[model samples]
Structures are given as C-alpha cells and as structure tokens.
Target: MGVRGLQGFVGSTCPHICTVVNFRELAEHHRSKYPGCTPTVVVDAMCCLRYWYTPESWVCGGQWREYFSALRDFVDSFASVGIKLVFFFDGMVEQGKRNEWVKRRLKNNREISRIFHYIRSHREQPGRNMFFIPSGLAIFTRFALKTLGQETLCSLKEADYEVASYGLQYNCLGILGEDTDYLIYDTCPYFSISELCLESLETIMLCREKLCESLGLCVADLPLLACLLGNDIIPEGMFESFRFKCLSSYTSVKENFDKKGNIILAVSDHISKVLHLHQGEKKLEEMLPLGPNRALFYKGVASYLLPGQSSPWFFQKPKGLIMLDKQVISMSSDPESKQGVPICTEPESKQEVPTCAHPEIKQQLPVETDSDFNLEVPMYAHPKIKEDKPMDMDSEIKQQVTLVSDPEILKVARMHHIQAESYLVYSIVSSGEIECSNTLEDELDQALPSQAFVYRPVRQRVYTLLLGSCRDDISASLAVKEWFVYPGNPLRHPDLVRPLPMIIPGGTPSLKSLWLNQEPAVQARRLDALLACFNLSSSRDELLAVESPLRALCCLLIYLFVQVDTLCLEDLHAFVAQALCLQGRSTAQLVDLQLEYISPRAVQLGSLLVRGLTTLALVNSACGFPWKTSEFMPWNVFDGKLFHLKYLQSEKGYSVEALLEQNRSWLTRFHNLKAVVCKACMKENRRIVGRGHWSSHHTGRWGRQGSSSHRTSSSCGHSGQGQPWRDQGPGSRTHEHDQWRRY
Candidate 1:
C-alpha cells in the first residue's frame, strides 16, 4: 500500500504537485522534452482494473465484450496520441503483505454484503456507485491486451516494483497508476488513473519533485516520510505516539490538506531537523516509534528501490532465460526471514534487486495424499533440458525445462493467445497456491448459492488434476493454499479443499499427456474426459459432431447444467438465447439499449455463466489448453445487459422463438443447442433418478422439451402448485424471490 493519506496530502498541494492535464497534452510535453523520441508510459494494470470499468462494471458478473471494447477505445486513444503503454500486473503473494491482502479482501466482502443488502432492502438493483472488481478480470484483460498486441509482463515478484524499475531504467515519461506507493518511489512522475477523464484523454499526475519541494524535503526523503505516515509495511496507527507529538508540535498547515496535511507537514519538518541525525540507531529510536527491527524501515523503503540497471531477463525473451550471476531470491516459507535485514544498507549505483525465481522451484511437487480430486501427476512426460542456457535457469524461462513438469506445459502457456493466464497456471504448478483477486457478485442473496463457493467442487477437482503430478521431493512452498471467496467469518484465508477424483471415460491421463498426444484416439479420449466431467459421457459422438464454432458454446452450457444443483427449462432456454445473441449483432444492439434495471435472478444467472466461463478457462489450463484462447472472450460470448434482457423476456413468458424474433436466424442454432442441452441433462437426470438421488416426480423437468407444466414448476422459482427439483430433492420454494423490481 502507498503512504497512508498521501493522495489527500498530494491533493492538498494542488497544481504545484498534482494537476489535471490531457493525457495527450502530457505526452506531447514529454515528447518536447525528448525531441524525436516516442513517449512511452509504464502502466500499472492493477490500478487500471480498479479505475477503468466504471458505470456498470461488475453489476452482473461483467459485460466482457463491452468492457473490452471500451478498453480498446482507451488504448486506441493512447496510440492516437503516439503514447505507447506497457502494462504490468502482480503475481506470487508476498509473505509480509498477507495481512494487508486479507484486510483488503474482507473490505471488498463488506461492499459485496452492502450491495445485496441495499437490493433486499430497496427491492431494486443498486446504482452505478457500488464498485467491486471481479476475479478473472486480470486474466481476461491480459487476453484483451494480447489481441491488441501490447507488450505486458506479470512479474514473479511484484508488479509495482517491476513497473517503477522499468520506467526508471528505460527513462520513460512516467508511471500511471493510483497506488500511493508510486509517490514514495523516487523514479518517474506518477499519474493518477482515477483522475483519467477518458473523454478528453486527461488525467491528474503528481510531480514527485514538486511534492517533495512543497514539503520542504529532498526527493530522497520521500520514502521515509511515507513510512512515518504509515504504509503497508508500517501501520498508520503504529505511529500513534509520533502522530500525537506531531499534532502538538505544529499548528494546522495553511494548506488545504486539512488535519492529515497538518500532520504530514509536521512530519516533514521533523524529518528535516533529524534527517542527518537519525543515521545512528540510538538517534533513530529517540526520534521515531519503531518495532524491534529498525531494518524493516529499510526493507519497506527498499521495496520501492529499483535496480541500477534493468535485469537481463527482459531482453532475453525469445533468446531464452540466461543464467544471471546474482543469486535469485529464495521463496522461503518464513516470510519474515525474506524481509529481514540485519542492518540498514543503502544501495549505490549498479546495485540490483534480487530476482525471485529459483532453481529449487523445480526441485519437486507435493500433492494431497488420497486427494478428493483423483489426479495423479504425470511422471512419464519427457522434457528436454536446454543445451544453450546453463543447467540452472529461472523456472520463469519459457523453454528451460526444470526437474518439475513438462516443457510442453510452458511452451503452450507462452503462446501469445494464452499468456495472460501464464502466471495463474505457473503459480499453481510451481507454488501450489492461487492468489485470487476480487470477484464481485451478490453473495448476500441466498436465493442462489455463492457463485465462488458453488464452483469449489469444480476447482478442487481442477487443482487435483492440475497439481496431481507425482514428485519424490516436496517442499513447504508446494503446499496447497488457494485464496478463496465465500460468506462471512473466514477472513480471507485460502480455505481448505477436500477434492474427490472425477472418473473420466477412458481413464484419466497426466496433464502432460493431455497436450503431447494428438492422435484421433487420444483426442477422442480427451474429449470423452471433458464430456464425463459434465455427465454427458454417453453423448460423446453428438458433441463431436457439433460444428467447431458451437462446440465450446455447447460445452459451456452443458457444464453450467451439470454444475448448478438445479435447473429449469426457462433458464436453460434463455442460456441458449444468450449464447445465440453472441453470434449475431445482438451485442451491438445491446450497446444502444439503456438497461436501467435488471432483476436479481438475471444477475445471478449471468454471474454464474461468467463464472462458468472462467472455470472452463481454468479447466482448459488444467488439460493443457486444447481449445483456442479466442473461444474464451467474454465480450464476444457474454454481455451482462443482453443476458439480463433475455432473462427478463424469459421471465415474462417469451418463447425461444419470440426471444429471438429480432434476429430469427438464431432460431436454428438456438434449437440445436437447446436439443443438445436438454439431451445432456436428460441423460444425466436419468442416472440421478436411477441412483434414487433425484425424485421421479420431477423427471419431466429436464425432458427433451420440458413439458409446459414442468416449465411452470421448475427450480428457477416460477411459483405454481407443484414441488420443484432441488439439490436436496423435490421441495417447496425456500422463499419468494422478488423477480421484478419496484418502479
């Protein structure tokens, strides 16, 4: 996190330190400074994700197509002005920051609770003001960037560190992001992504030199000043005693920063007096409140420090990972040890930050014994160790085969189309942990199970299948710790999962086996495994016969049908309509329609589909990405507005033909998918009924056409005089869901 209250502190300084200017104008100014040089800015992808999608961002999972379309517009604007942006994202959790991570996650969870509460209390969906970032956005965004052919990197260390380092090393114009930490770094000027006025291409930027000048300190003093005010490594409340003294020592500043500004100014003044004096340990304790480790202050400040020169890895891309002479940082289980410094040491010119990837990262993999998701690691997958690079290279290198798994895994992942998820799959494979980001949805609405939670069974199976490799040696880093999302009280820990093995038709194969073999027989077996996951093992031939364009779509629908505990004809039929809408001009039409209100049911269903899409992406990753990456585009396949509209039409009793009346061409493909979905469910439900797991009374609910009476009484809670199929079997509706909003 950035210095606490620094945004306010900088805002108080106004035009001197921070000012709003057209982004193009700023780029032009930089170009003038460099004469003949192109203006390139290193963008913080995390910050962009938070600020970019405004005014209906994650209201119903996401409007991926539109979101991406808008993202392209922003990028095109940058290009239109001759500004090149290189985006960076974070990966691999830092030990010291877990608490901060948990705190932020819980805070987002509170917003989730509030959004649904507002809906339950008001009987209408909340307005555009509620902000929450959903999961898979980063992966999705990376995909979007790839389509645009933008250069991007997901650091094995931290994105912020890499971003600042890249900017300073390359002598870029500045770093653009909202993170307060950018202010603490003495590298390039920092611009606020939040202050971006997309229409005019204007954004607010902070002049660090001016900020330091106004505060009466040197640029070198910024990090210490930020620490004194509190940061991620240092809590703001940790300086209560110092804060009290600062408040008493100075009167309120004449600036507009208010009380926080007064304290900041006071701290700066105090720093000026003791700047040289606190070089000694005794003087430091006398001047500041610090923990036992004064070195932590150094480390926190050092986290912002950039290497004297850029790493060789950035330039070694296609040439492959060359061994660096410097020792790579160890990912120790003891995080404190990694952050520990015996004494504060300042870096001189030519010093380099420790790289994070290590040789032992490939030493071995450990999987849960008797794992619930029955998957065995593929030991037979042969990979060649590079003859060009040294025997030891960073696991991050694209082709350097480690003692870990197949080189093919990395080769496939490095493809331009799928590189966005490169870190996600790599982290899971290398570290056995997945650092989940914020996924916005109506968790508070009990009408549906938490979408994330609902998918755990799927994920657990995925983890086992992906991480199921057998390695003789296992390390602490290999222990499974997945960042999870669910209802109250867990407080952001990676919730434990007890996965069960899924029985594939021709027996499960190693992840390596999934990718290496491409025989018709092998491909058929892989397809059968995918079908078996959705309870459609018997209909393999039918799925195989589907047109390739509709194959992924059919798999998604069938997956949704299998995953959801219960289903209905209306919901299932609407799913086809939504999928059909993607293949036509409907998304463009949706862009023109103003959808002010969407019922909770539509949001839930749409959110579930989006979640399903991401899960399938994860599945594809686990199975070595047999499907094309383009098949996963949320924008092409999913539009939240379009989904909600179709849902409302279905709720109002519109037939499939009527729902597609605007584009009747969809009717043919629509029924084809409908027949496939109904057949898939019918086969699966027969098995459920045979096992006595589902009641015979509701067997018609998933029948070929789903009799009109069955449609009237299905699990989507279209209330009628009949019991409906539920996960717990035929049951009465739990509660009346307000399907329509109050006008």
Candidate 2:
C-alpha cells in the first residue's frame, strides 16, 4: 500500500529526504522561539500499537496488562510536557485496499509458519523480527485510552488521511507515525514514531522541503514520484520498462539495475527536465508503457489533498465518525458546519482584531520548568477558559473480540449503529475477516478449524438474547447462523458444523430478567446461572467463602471439562495453579515466559477455556454488564506457556499443595474449591430441576408410562436410563415431559 522500496531508498541514498532530530531539542526550540504557543501532536494510534505489542514474549497470544502499562507511560510523557496529543485510529474499509489487505495476510501466514518452525527447532521464543500484532489490539487500545481519559478519535476511514488533514487543519507540530505515505501528503511536518526515545521526547522528523529542494522538484511533484516508483494505486510491474530505462542511463552510482535509490535519482532527473514545460503530460505518458494513467496518477495526488476544515473543537465531521472525550461521545452531520467548545475561530468584526491578552495581563515573571522540562501549565492562559486535562493513569477496569461476523450482527454492529458493540466506534475496523485465536487442531494439518465452531454454542446463546427470538426455549439458540472469515485457510468441516450447545439450569434468569431485574438476589441468581452453564452448582454461602475475582474463571474451568472429553483433573489443577502464579502480581513483575511450539492438544484445553470466557463476557455485555470483565480477562487468569509448564508438574502426580507450593490453609482453600468442581463435574448433567420438580422427577415415583411399580432411588437421579424424559444438552429431549408432572 506504500511506495515499494522508497523508504529505504531515501533513508539510505537520498539523505536530504529524511531528517533525524531530537524531539526534546525541538520542544526546547519551540519554547525558546514561541513561548506562548502550546505544541499539539496528532498521533497515528495503529502505528504505536503494533510497535508496543510486537517485541513481547507472548506476541502470539498477548500480555494485556503489560501492553496497557506501556500505553499509559507513552501518554504521560507528552501530557507532563504540556504537549497536547490527539490520537486518530483507522476506521473503515476503503474500496481499492481490499486486495492489499489480503496480500499482507497471506504474507503473514508464511511468517507465522516460520515462527512455528523456529520455536520448535530452536526450542525457544523467536526474536522481534518474527511477530504479528495479536487480534483485538486496536479495540483494546481504544478501550484503554478511553479508560485513561485521553482525547482520542476513531476515523470514519483510513487514519493516515485523517491524521494528515487534522494536523494541517489545526496547525500541529507534526503527524507522529511510521508510515512512509506520510511523506507524500502535503500536510504539516511528518515525524518518525520509531526513532522516538520517549524518556527525553527526542525523535526525528521527515523534512519534505529539504528533499524537494535537493531533488529539483516542487512539493506538488511528490505524488508523481510515488506513482513512478510504484505505489498501491498503480502496480510496480507496469512501470518496470521505464525504471530499467532510467537505470541504464544512470552510471554515476554502480548498483543493481532495479535498485530503488538509483531509480529514484534517475526518475527525478528526468522529471526535472520536464518541469514547468508544455510537455508535462506527454513526457509522463512515456513512463507508462502499459497505458496512460492520468486518472490514477491524479487520484493518488488527490488522496494527499486535505479535506474540510473541522478543528479539534469540532471534528473530522464525516458520516460515521464520532468524537470521544471523558464527558461525552459526539458526532457531526454536516461538513460545512462548525460545532461546540464555545470558542471563536475568527474575529466578530473585521474592522477590529481581538487580542488574546491585554497589556495589564501580560506576564512579567520567568516561568520555572520541572526536572524533565515539564512546564507547570500552558504558557498563555485565557481568563475565562477552563483546562479539562485527562487524568494521567493506567487502565483500572479494562473491559475487552473475535472471528466471524454474523449476518444478523450486521443489523446492529454496523457503523453509526446506536449499539455499543458496533464497529463504527473504532476508527478503522478490519475490513478482512479473522479466525478466532485459541482454536483446536484436527487430524494434524487441516486448514485449521473454524474458531467460530469453538465458540458458536456460547455466541449463539448470546445472539438469541441480543437479537431476540420467537422461540422462548434455550434450544432456539441452535438456530442462529454465524459466518466465519478464514481468509486463505479453507475449513475442513463436513457441514461446517452447527451451534455449540450451551448447558445451564432452567431456573437461571432469562436475558430479560437479567436486564430489567435490579434486585441483589437477581444478581446472585445471574452468577448462579452463569456457573450452572459449566455445571458448577454451588450454594450461596459456599460461593461467598470463595473470592469473587476467580469465581467466573473457576466456573469456566468446569465448563471446559464438560465440553472437552479428554480434559482431566490435572488440567483443572494446572489452570488454577497459574492463577496462583498471578497472585497479586504487578504489571512490571509479570514473568515473560516463552514457549517452543507444541501440539494444539498440549494447549487446546486452555484455548477452550479462553473461548468460554469470551462467551461469558458477551453474555454479560448483553445484560447491563453487572460483572467486571477486567477481573476475569484471560491475561489475568491464564498464561498458555505457564499452564503447560505447570501441567507437566501435575502429570507426575503432584498434590494440590505441592503444585501451589503453599501452606496448609491454602491447601484447605484449594481442596474445598476443587471438591466443589469435582462433585458438579463428575457427570455432565445437562439440566438441574427446580426444588419441587427435583422431588417429583427423582424420588416421587417411577415413570407413569413405563414401569409404574418400580421405585427410583435418589442415587439414580442423573442416571442415563431412568426417566428418559428430562430436558438435556448433548443428551436428547424425550417427549415424556407431560407424564412426569404431578397432579
């Protein structure tokens, strides 16, 4: 999507094209030159997100707590310096970029294969070069920033365009990012986020004017250079003939015939010949041996042109774009219209200009700076204006995604859709589809199973409630259809399978009751119902004894045992053992353990539990979200590599106390929790009858229709052969419900 080899070509060959300067130096110069001005930097958030998350040990999965901490430090560095920051995120799928997106994914697949091979062969984690950003990173970033109280916006379209335009519209210090395309835009200055040493705010800025002067080309000629060098709009192959022609004539520097810098120098030399001439179009057409590209060339140049005039006080003002702040979420309908903040962009009367400060109000004292040159406040303050600075802190309640978009989800999940789950809230939602992470493998090398199938049962239950349905019974969830986006990987399913069956007690509150009923007892019933889905039936007093933080996760493990047949008590102990590993750990203290690739079977149990947790969150979101999802997030509860290491310890028959390496009281707590899980999970009982129904079904009498004289024992309550008439999950529902009722 960028110039094929231009970043390196200019960075190495044409030194004038790129400039490396310290950001602290720039800040000092700004302070010394214009002491009254506040420097504002517009940031491309996606660029920073990939950089921050890529170098970690668990890039394949994620270290969310560490990632969240990195984001806080990044923001505070600017805020403490009195530098205002506005973050823009990429939002929609542009028409021509779909193919580009697919190509990159296929490329990443090759890299991912190499990563798997390297980890297994070398028996260690791969270095920084081999990594891809984990799924749901953007959503996580936005959620974190919002929670951090920072000023941010999700773009209605591509963020680079919005970033460049916003920078130019507001007269920003620069557009801070790593994209080479930023050089092509005629916006404000472009800065390199990669070169930034945040501790001192020292970084490099790309000086476009220096490059233009050195190359004998005008600022207007930048887009033409990008096209001639081969960008996203026009294929590089189309200009191969012209590039070789330029390469042959340039003998000053002996390099590869198709070397990027050599070609850049040659092409610009030719461009200099045609500048301000009558033959500009005719001369440029010669480079297009395939055909003339006046339309596309114009389009590429037009993309760099800034649109509209919405300031930060307003917004980008596109159809689906919304402005986010701590106080409110607002959107603009008309491009030509200005919006809130109660400030004036122009003077009320042209005859008399308004001055910011009166002579009497001018400052007389020299301002003092902090240790890091952090100014106490913005140099110039207005008498009436209030500074609503965001709280500089980390994410306290980070609530956090998925492959497969249901066709029905489009009804409410579209851009500008009022629903909170709508993707429009993101600046740029992924145009392409993704497979769910933590998927199980089948028969060794299939096109990978649909991560959808893994979570379908849970999601379908959620879909039934969120989207509504005619059938009131839980079985109605089975009818919901979800479409998975596998990209290049074709699934091996015989019929793509169907709904994942969710098993919970009938007495659990309905979606309606969870939402409308605000009583404390209703909350207790909701938790009970959630646990019952995993078949962990606990009394209120028993649950109160256990910590609430790990209750949902403990219930999740039992659910995994019920769903996954191969899972044993060892697996249950392994997951809980990691929870012990996470006992009161800080963001800095988290052990960065790595892994050598193993069988999905080795870690598939953890994956299943992870998916199960996602289901719980989705269900919670559908209701009023009474539960704190942050407390139950996968990062807080499980680490795949740590689980595998702990599991091996348990496989050798380690006792619960030995596994946790704790005292007798901890053993008591572990044994008690494990006892509850073991009892409820001994047999996968799909349904638990109500108090009155329980007595009638198991102890009252034998079945009316069959063996009326036989007496049923309480021990045979959950037996498969007994009544054959109760509701079930995985087990079939018999048509004998009417016969079991008492008069």
Candidate 3:
C-alpha cells in the first residue's frame, strides 16, 4: 500500500504504538471474560486497513502487521469467532475527511494481479475473515452501513451488547476509528479504540461506566449520548455555536451526495450574508481556500441541524384546522408583512392613535398609528407614545421651521407622519355559544345530543359565532365547547401561512381542543413539553380520517403516560404482554415507571395478575376480565382501593369464550392493520423492514392507506393465539413472589 495524499500523515501508518497497545489491551480483556474463549477479531474496512492505518515510513511495519496477524491466530486458538474485515468507500465520509487525507495516486497495474491481490486472496486471509462490502467511498457512512444488512447487524449488535452486560444482559466494548454519532440504536455500546482493554472484562465495564457518567447518562444511554456529542467527543455542548459560527465564517458550498454516491444536488454557488456572497456567482472562489475547510464545513452542517426557536412552538398547539381570526386587521397594505397575533390590548385602547416620544422606538416601529398596533406586529417602534402627541410636535414644527434642517428633528417629523396614518386592528374572540337553526327544541337543551338537529316550522333560528376567524379565511372556525374546542380545517382552503399535520379522524382529538377538555395529550404535553402536541392543519373536514394502527398505538402510548390514571386493566395487560414484547428489551424499560415503590415480590404478583388478566382476555369471548374472577381478585378490590374492570355484559348467559374472542379480535385487528402497513412498505421496496412503516419516511404513506385494513382485520380474524389459555394458578401463591422490578 502506498501513501497518496494526507494518508502519508502519521495516522495512515500501519500500526502506531497506541493502536497496538489498545488492541492488545482489548484482546487480553476478552480472554479473561471467557477463560478459554478466544474470538478471532477481523479488521473490516472498505479499503485496505493497512493503507489507512499505517504510515508511509515505519521502523518495522512488516513486523507490526505480523503481530496483528499473530494476535488473530492467538484469539482463534480457543474458539474462532470470525470477524469480517469489511471495507466500504463512502463519498460523504471521504469528502468530510478530504482535507485530512493525502491525495490519491493512480498506478497502472496488471488487471489479474490487482484483482487477485485486492479481492480473492487477501479477502480470504488465514484465520481471519475479510469482506469487502460493495459501496461508494463518497457516500455517507450511514448509507454504507445500511447496505451492509442493518437488520443482521442490529440483531448481532443487540446480542453482543446483551452478553457483555452485568446481570442478565450483555454490554459491548465499542471500537471504531469513525465517529461515535453512528450509534443511535438503543442497544449499541460505543467505546473509543483506546477504551477497549486486553486484561479483564472489568476494564471494559469501568470504561463504559465512566463514559456513561461523564455524559450524564446510564450505561444504556450511550447511543443517544453519542448522537449528541458528534465525532471524537469535542468538548460537550459546543455543537450549538459551532454551526452558527461555521455558516458565518465560510462561503463555499459543497455538492450534495444522495443515498447512492451520485451527486443529486449541485452547489451552484455559495450564498452567505456574512461575506455577502450571492447565488449564481462564484464570488467566494477567489476568497476561499481551494481545499476543504473542516471547521467551516462542520459549522455549516450544525447550523442546518439547529432549528429556529419558533418552529417548535409553532406546532405546540395542534389547533385542528387552522382558522384565521378576522378580528386582527393590519394597517399595512402588504399582505406578506401582515400577520395575526394574539389580541392582548383592549379594543377601546386601539381607538386613539398615539405619538412616539422616544426617537429609537419611533424609528423602528411599523407605520401603525394606534398604540395597540404593537400587539399585532412583531416589531414595536414607539416607546413613549402615551406621553407624546403628534399634533403638538407638528405645532412646534410650524413655529420653529429652522429646526427641520436638523437630522434628529427631521426624524421626529417622520414619526409625526407615521402617527398621522390610520392603523389596522386585529380582533380575536373566545367561545360564544351557537345553536343550529334546524335543531328541535327538545334536543337543544340536552348535554350530549346524539341526533342531528331537526328544523321546526315557524321557529326562530338560533346561532352564534363561537370564535372569530381571520379575515383572509372565512371557511375555518374555532369553536369552543364546555369540554373542548373544535377547529375545522377545510382541505380546499389551506392556511397559507401555517402548515399543520392533518388530524387522523378517530385519532386522538386535537391537543388544543383536548386542553379545553383536559384530554391526555394536553396532560402529557404539560408533563413533557417535547411531546408532540396537536395543531390545526390541512385535511380537517373529512368525516373519517382513520389514523394508521401504528399511529393509534403511539397515540395510546402517549395517552397512557399522560393520563394521571394507570393504564386500564386490559390496556396494561395488552401493553405488557404484547406491545412491550414487540418493542424488544430496550424499550421495555420505558414502561417501568410504576416499578420503583412496589417490591419485586409484589411486582411479580402484579405481573402475574396482568399476565393472567391478559391471558384471560385473550381466551375469553365474553370480554370478561380475569380480575372479575373471584378466586384471583385482589383484597383491595373489596376495599375499593385498587382498579376493577367495569363489566360490559349484562346477561348471565354471557360466555367467557365469546368475551375472549371479542377482545382478541380487537388486538388481532390492531396487529393485522400493522401487518398491512408492513406489507405496503415491502411492496414498494422488498428490502424494506416490516417495521419500516414506523420510520419517518414511510409514516405518511402508511397513514394515507387508512382504516380499511383495521376494519377488515378487526371483523375477519378469529382469536387463534388468544384461545389457548392455561391459568397460571391463583393470585395469592403468585402474589407472594413478585417478578416485575423497578429501576
């Protein structure tokens, strides 16, 4: 291997002391963990590892390679756990590392020799497995990794990490020259190449714990921690300002690489406000260095990742179906500049136009004459408008015309001109009750009316405006009710200014509307502000916009956590026995909120109760809960302290088999709907995972397919899995030995 560009640097060398020391340390540690277990570790790289790791000049490069080869053989002596030395060329990764790498030098070589040397023979090295994963070097590393069988890697990673954990689980000793940000999955454990030790497993564990503690996280949280710190662990929390500074500092733009290595979006020119660079002009070509600017490039990426403050808050309230408030009127003729703000000032206060006394506020203020105009506009110019009168300033201006020549005096005159103009008013309304003109007198007074309103002959019409809409859009309405407010978004008329996610009909109601009713979404938002709250958006008027099953599941999960009450008996059982199981072990811990106070013994008893109840529900057709059974009932049920499932069946003739069939049908349908989504995803891309529908890319596609699968699956499937129920014995014996323990 020859050193080309920056690869001639020290890092490109074959095996430096630290690299040897680190790998040696890790090898020894693995030996201790599995006394006789010697795992043959492979060096997987997209290119020749020696080319990237070894320097151009070495005191004993051949000897070091021999040492690594020997280490592989020694590890394989007991049990050969083969590792693939796979190399992938990612263009983005390459581009990111361009400045750091030495230039490549092409050399003409015999085709047969090159092919045999680089591929067939070398890939099948003795005692060590090597795989050259086909990939473009210019693409992102994530793309290369994805192509390398994510599902297989995910499974293996999970297993390896679990085996290394302290108790029943395994942990991993992460080793990679690449950035730690690559680990986003919950199970992946990350350690620097230096962290892995060769002595005992304790070194690995200690390193893992120390890293976790330094990051203010648990051992399990390393993946998330890595995502935030970015590469090579620069001082924490520096990523924020780094992006801003980068964008401001540099003006060069790089070409965009797609998932494949093709250049999808070309960088026509670099545009920057700081340097005053413009599009379609190579202004920065002369100013910027020809090579990659690492600091500047990284900062630009950080800026893109950093979202504006308003975007998060804009979606805080899922105002179902955005309706404009007609009450707010802007005096500015420009519609683009005109915006609606919350009505904070009294209507009467806006009647009198105020003059600005302060020069700074006057100069910055929009041309709104009214004092209350500041409430609607984003910028406020006048500070002392209450004390200053435009007419008085004008009168003095006429008396002392010579003062007009002064710049400060001229600015005051400009303020007076603005004060003379009329300002627009934006009015907002709260809830006002309205009655349907066709509603029957008898049905009008009832709290929960099931039937539509019927028109009465010779009856006076009754109706009221609930919440006023913005003048621009009259079709949308914000109606406040005793419990909740409904904002209707007519799909035909999308609020141009604010884009909202369509509410899935039968999905959870809009969070803002729920706020009026104290719904779980609102409760959860209060508990965790980062939680997605509902907002008014397009596609509001559909009679049935059924949310996809996965969306429904998320909705329910959010509801369960947000709701003050513990999960309902049936839901809790289904969540634990089925939902948690589907989520794998990592997320199962998320539902362990209730485990802390209760004893492990008590928990096992409760889990049994939950399991039995879930099993009973699965098997019974009567839809009767197991807690309803007298034998397994908790003593507190008699005292009315614990939860009790409310019975649905009235007749004694109700069959347990029937209830189980019904409940299981519901669960089966839910699963089947999920399956439909999974199948739909596979249809588009055969390689896509069954769980891909849950991914951000496929969420919209799955949602649009809608309720049909759920309805059909719900009605059609028989409760096959739910039918085989063996009672796990009565509660007292099981309650004595609790199993579910809290963290």
Candidate 1, 642: how far from true, in Å?
A: 1.3
What's model 1's lDDT at 349?
Answer: 11
Q: Which is superior by lDDT, 1 or 3?
A: 1
Against the correct fold, how does model 3 do in TM-score? 0.19
lDDT value, candidate 3, whole model: 0.23
Best by TM-score: 1
List the candidate numbers ranked by TM-score, top first. 1, 2, 3
lDDT of 3 by residue, 463-523 (tens): 1111112242542332211110011111111111111122233443322232234544444
Write the residue-wise lDDT of candidate 2 on 170-270 in tens digits. Answer: 67778899887888777889998888888877777888787788667777677667777877666677678877887677556545533677788777776
Instruction: Look at candidate 2 and give me any clashing residue pairs.
Output: 23-202, 23-203, 90-427, 90-428, 91-427, 91-428, 154-427, 155-427, 457-500
Per-residue lDDT tens digits of candidate 1, residues 1-743? 67888877676554578777777877889888999888988898978987667535466667677677778888898899899988877755565567788788778878877876775677565766776665567777877887888876665545677678677767788898988888877688788888887778888778888877877787767777877888877667767678769768766457545778788888888777655454443434345665554545544554554543221111111211112222112132333432222121222311222222323233222221011111111110111122233222223343222323654554454332223554356666555556665555555443454455455555655555665563546422234466655554354346433333566765777766776776666665666555544445677776766766567767777766654434556776666787677667544666675554657666667767777677777766666566666776677677777777777787678877788866767888787777886687566552212112344454323222233222232333445332221222221222111111100
Assess every candidate by TM-score. 0.77, 0.63, 0.19
Cα distance off (Å), candidate 2, residue 555: 5.6
Q: Looking at candidate 1, what is the lDDT of residue 485?
A: 52
RMSD, one per candidate, in order: 10.0, 15.2, 27.3
Task: State each model's CA lDDT, in order.
Answer: 0.59, 0.50, 0.23
